[model samples]
Target: MSQAVTLWIPGLLDALRVKEAQASLKDLKLPALQTLLAKADKFAVKPQSFYEQASFLFHQPGCLPIAVTKASAELDEFNPNHFWLSVDPVQMIPDRDTLVLVPGKALQITEQESKALLQKFNAHFAEDKVELIWASSQHWYLSIVQPVDIQTTDIEKLAYQSVNAFYPKGNAAQYWRQLLNETQMLFYTHPVNEARREQGWPEINSVWVWGEGKIEADKLLIRTDASIHSNHAYLQGMANLTQSHYCAEPESYQAWLNQIAGFSDPGNGEIDKHFICLDSVADKLDNLQLDEWLTLLQQLEENWFAPLLQALKRDEIDSLLLDLGQEYRAHLKPSHLNRFWRFKKPLNSL
Candidate 1:
């Protein structure tokens, strides 16, 4: 049996802005990545955000069950019977006539502040039969006794963009919108925001509600014996639900190989497939921190792409699939690495 690996890297191909950076693309020596792109067979996929791609890969095709999946990972005791939604805090910046959403991750919201904010929110909304639970500074959950019909856009898709077009839409849209407005008003005057204003940090002026759904048993598409490695809460939840082997995101390809080396022999035909999600560039890309993105790209070149190519050459892995976000997939085998005639392209060309 041969082992196969898949790498899901969002924002890998969105290098158009990198071209404008002071750093020359020619100066970035990512021979391994360049070669992989030059030689591999490419396939087009439907464009999707990181969360959507992860959900699709796990076989949940429609609106992502983000709340339930993430709750399973974040909560000490998760109840699948209750419907859940991710009501994460966000900074809504007034950009002229439009309001731009800044994701919670960029707000540097502390656990203390999150607790304080949720304490007030829960009390005010308690009569509505919905309770807010603080899972982390970046993730808060709403537990509802009754299911509501509403469609939401993930915060990842709405980050740094206008919120006008992406507001929740459905039968319960108006209700949610109103609730959001109320929450924003409540947070606007909170001491947390006052302190943040003094410190020059963005205020948590609003909450973004998304990832609403309950968990369905045995719905994951992943093989029971497959291994998953990621730091993402939803991905961890999927792994737990499927009872698949799961580990934290590895620091590098070498680190992953070392960690998995202790597993049952590959010859047993039980653990031939592996999925790894590398999202280091995700936040940087979302925040439009191009300089940091460039630095991380170089680190990826040194830590992952180079070693992965070597692994293919050594037959340590039979094949590799690169999910280079934004509707692109590249498949490569050891044989593909032998395509010396294929010219390597600059990283910016991707």
Candidate 2:
């Protein structure tokens, strides 16, 4: 119970830039966040994407490896004891200049289509002891008899980007690359793609395998008193392993408040810590949805920032922590709110 609340908001700078462009900061009602920012201590850290930042919170390099396939397996109700890797179905669009791979999340992929595709993968790779499991149309898992040492990039990270640059890296990079290339060719003329084409659906041309690792016993070593709440599978897995309370994502800030309104005070006399993940902006950015991203920022100002600011003023929370991904985090205590003389700058100023 070292913290009263930790507000996890990704793409703060991008949101800020959009907000500032659409309207002036003074026009927005975010006094709590603004005041805290004006007075809170700030530091620079390494730049990382939302997934990278989230991954580091629970798993230390080597201590708590990110068994993404296993975590995703739990979501799919698939067995987690086997060695696995994430293999997302994607559509590769060839351009006159370059070829881009659009993530499956952006396409309309059905469960039946996924099952058929996975069957094909399993049949083709059966001799190699590699099998593909359809967790969902967007999430697929690859099970192998032996572990793969190659590190691959997240599919979301490569969405709408060139696939040529995403060749696996590490000891077994060549084998993985060859396997992936072969699979793409195998899927190119699959009956599923033909059926999808007839039905006007995007083709499942390739798969991106990444987050390869086994679930380590020490994956939950970073124990914290903070309660975990998120809609993400990985966070839920982390919470389950850490034995912390896990709540589904709230549709509104009011819903979230209702869920944690009665949090019991730790007997150690420390304030209860609440960790929240609000990632709509990041998701929008990945999908190139600028308008939706801007709208979400406006809603955040009205729902989250305004309400949390009022909560702090009422002394319901001891402090606020904003994780803007990477090394950019703001720690704001109630006392900081009183620093009226401190200059309030826009988010991009930092």
Candidate 3:
């Protein structure tokens, strides 16, 4: 039986901004990745958020049902009937004429802090028939009895960028914008922010509202046979929706191989398809930490790209699909590996 693997690597193609680091890339030996890119068939795709890309893979495209899908996975008793929106905590840095949105990952918000913050938010807006639900320290949800008509920008796109241009837009835009301002003011004086300030941590001063939608049973297009390996809540939720084999991502390619080797068959044929997301470089790329990004790339070269290339060569995997997020994808087979004449190119060239 032939097996195939698809890798979703978000920051794989981002350019290194630091001039000093450009030289370091030359020193980094990623021969396996270089060869795969050099010989594989490549194509362009419309730039999209990581959530959108994952949704596309699960056949739930267009304005992804991100909130409900993720809520279903996080919430103990998820009510698919209610409309959901991801009202995740964030910090807005005021810069001259704009506010730079810092995502929650940098905040390192504790569970106690999240619960305290949400308690205040939920009480303040309780009369509005909307409640803030704490899914995790980093993940929060807004449950609404009646869904509103507004489009939201995914927090990922707004991270480290000015929020002036990306504020929620649609017929109900003004309402959501007002709500955002109110929430910011509500959190401004909260003990959580006060404690965070004293600790030299970024304040969870506001919430970024996005991924507003309800999950419909008919909309769930599931492919149960394929295995999904990711640490992302949204993808894991999709796996649950599909009732597919889902597992947290392994530390490395070898670790993943070891995990699947122990799987027992339940009268079904061996699962030949796998989807893996390796997104560790995304935060480094977003924060412009060039050295860290290069280090991670080198690590991936050693742990994932190198092993995957060898797997393809040995026919352990018949084909490999590399989704190098935003615009570039590479498809490779064993024969492609034999294309030694296709000279390897520099990492940045892709």
Off-target runs (Cα >4 Å) in candidate 1 are 21-23, 27-29, 57-63, 93-98, 194-202, 217-219, 265-269, 285-298, 325-327, 338-349
Cα RMSD to the true fold for all candidates: 3.4, 3.9, 3.1
Tell me the tens digit of each residue's lDDT in model 1 across 2-24: 67898887766554565565365
**Per-residue lDDT of 45 in model 3:** 77
lDDT of each: 0.81, 0.68, 0.81
- Worst ten in a row by lDDT for model 1: 55-64
Query: Which lDDT tens digits does candidate 2 get at residues 146-258?
Result: 67677878776788888777778999898888887888899989999888789888889888877787666654454455566677777676666555666776656688777
- List model 3 lDDT by residue over 1-350, tens digit each: 66788888775665334344677666667898889889999887776767778877555645448898898789997887888899998999999998999998878888999899999998998887568888899889987777789788888788899999889988989988998899999999998898888988888999899998987767766666678888878878888877677878878998889767745567544666788886545545666566766777778889998999989888999978998653668999899877868998876555
Candidate numbers, best lDDT first, in rank order = 1, 3, 2
* TM-score between candidate 3 and the true structure: 0.85
Report how far off residue 176 is in candidate 2 (Å): 1.9
Candidate 3 collision pairs = none
lDDT of 1: 0.81
The clash count for each model shown is: 0, 0, 0
Winner on TM-score between 1 and 2 is 1
